[model samples]
Target: MIVISSGSNHANAQTSMNTWAGATAQRVAYSTSRLQNRPDSAVTRDVRSALWRTPNLDASGIRVRARLGTVTLTGWVPERRQISLAGHAARSVRGVRSVSNQLLSRNSR
Candidate 1:
């Protein structure tokens, strides 16, 4: 005859449950991080498009980086207004949480 103890069965079940819970938590975390980056990518694209549409702002020299919906603009512009213009254009994007304008003026030196 085969005999199975209840306590042993309970402990085995608990271990399986814990393992499954850990795996599920990891998957959720990975999915959340992946989804979060999508918006930031879209924000970068939208900011670049906005700059291209604006006049007198040369977007070719501008660099746009986005993380967690915040955008950092780095590059050179000919005038001070162009800096403000770049910031404004970045802010206009829907997914942009904030803007860090670091544009340098060519004549500031």
Candidate 2:
């Protein structure tokens, strides 16, 4: 009777493992479909590029990262206003959901 109980427990464990694996696979597929449906990623890239090329704003030292419709501006700029400008520029983008201005001011040379 003990041996039979052990076998049942093993079977239950295997079943649980299989369920977990199926759940994981479903999650992966869902994530992939969601990502494929995301339309803002391309817009974010375009916005970053436009910001980088905007006149009067020095984008050389700035770094831009975007995820899930949010754009994060990092690195350094020469003036405080540049940080705001970067944020504004990012916001002007068509698909930008939000902008996080993390730009640091650099001392003048």
Clash counts per candidate, in order, are 0, 0
- Tens digits of per-residue lDDT, candidate 2, 1-109, equal 1123556887777778888999999999998876552365686677678788777788888877778778888898887778788888888876677888889988778
Question: Would you estimate the TM-scores of all the predictions?
Answer: 0.62, 0.59
How many residue-pair clashes does candidate 1 contain? 0
Give the winner by TM-score. Answer: 1
Off by over 4 Å in 2: 1-41
Q: Which ten residues in a row have the lowest lDDT in candidate 2?
A: 1-10
CA lDDT, every model vs. true structure: 0.85, 0.78
Residue pairs of candidate 1 with colliding backbone atoms: none
True-vs-predicted CA distance for residue 52, candidate 1, Å: 0.6
